[model samples]
Target: MSTLTHHKKSVRAMAQHPKDINSFASVSADNVKKFNLPNGEFLHNMMSQQKTIVNAMAVNRDGVMATGAAVFALSYDVTGTRLVTCGADKTIKMWKKDQNATPETHPLNFKPPKDIRRF
Candidate 1:
């Protein structure tokens, strides 16, 4: 089993609109503008997806690296060997220092918005 799944503590969380992954001001602004569409779905996509960035990372005794959700909060065990993360998906994930914990993105397959007129 993966180190994350093997953790003893697990909890359900509430999803929230997380911060942007783009640290550079220009890139983040351009993206926000480029992706800001009249449709709400498009806006939501840009905002939530960026939160999947790796905020924290740790290397274990075996020298393997692991990461946590970027925009969300992070926690570590007393020894700093185990890590925990809360992401926009509202799930708290845990991983050992050696585990490769990466965020998975499920893209939204959406159609362009269509305007409706009154009959």
Candidate 2:
């Protein structure tokens, strides 16, 4: 028998939050790493802290979804509602932030449909 190993892809996009100076990046390892850029230099070992997986990334807009992630098809809406994400899992999700939300959680939703293709 033979064994196969797959490697996760590197970061897809790196963007700075328009509302804040903090840096945000989505790595293919299913993680959205956040960091603070004191200067131009990137701080090291920051990913080891959160140790979470994101896969995709999007910014906040008009009191809508702030951050979202998936395996693939990551979309960032700079001036709209809903952060759309589609992945290899053959699914699509729409995340949004609700104004009347509570702490430790933001109002967001997802839709599981067939794969979505965008040009």
Candidate 3:
């Protein structure tokens, strides 16, 4: 198995185990890797054909959810409230920040994040 790491806040391979609601865990190919949330928590990973060297990784500057494929890209609004993600299947997903929840600790609430398809 190979890992990818890039960007100031985005990392490819998890260096530790998922500890609390402050980190993000990845589940793929029967492996569970742990990742710390950069800037805040949670984000999308970039990939192609579900099997290739991931190109880039970046933090959302805030938080978000995804769908229809492993996240291949991620972006955020200037205020760090809105999040957007692109999946390996070529689907783009968008999420509205939960203004009530703490941005840095939000994604921890949803392990194995559920991707909400943008219609």
Clashes of each: 1, 6, 4
Residue 73's lDDT within candidate 1 is 60
Clashing residue pairs, backbone N/CA/C < 3 A, model 2: 30-53, 30-54, 31-53, 31-54, 31-55, 65-97
Structural RMSD, model 2: 11.5
How does candidate 1 score on lDDT? 0.34
TM-score ranking, high to low: 2, 3, 1
> Which stretches in model 1 have alpha-carbon errors above 4 Å?
1-71, 98-119
Overall local distance difference test of candidate 3: 0.42
Which residue ranges in model 2 land beyond 4 Å of their true spot? 1-9, 19-39, 43-52, 61-70, 98-119
Model 1, span 1-119: residue lDDT tens: 21212112232221122132221110121121112212222222122123333444433333323334433665555555777777778788876633443344434564432431110
lDDT of model 3, residue 103 = 55
Full-model lDDT for every candidate? 0.34, 0.46, 0.42
Whichever of 1 and 3 has more TM-score, that candidate is 3
Task: Report the C-alpha displacement of residue 42, candidate 2, in angstroms.
Answer: 1.8
Best candidate, lDDT = 2
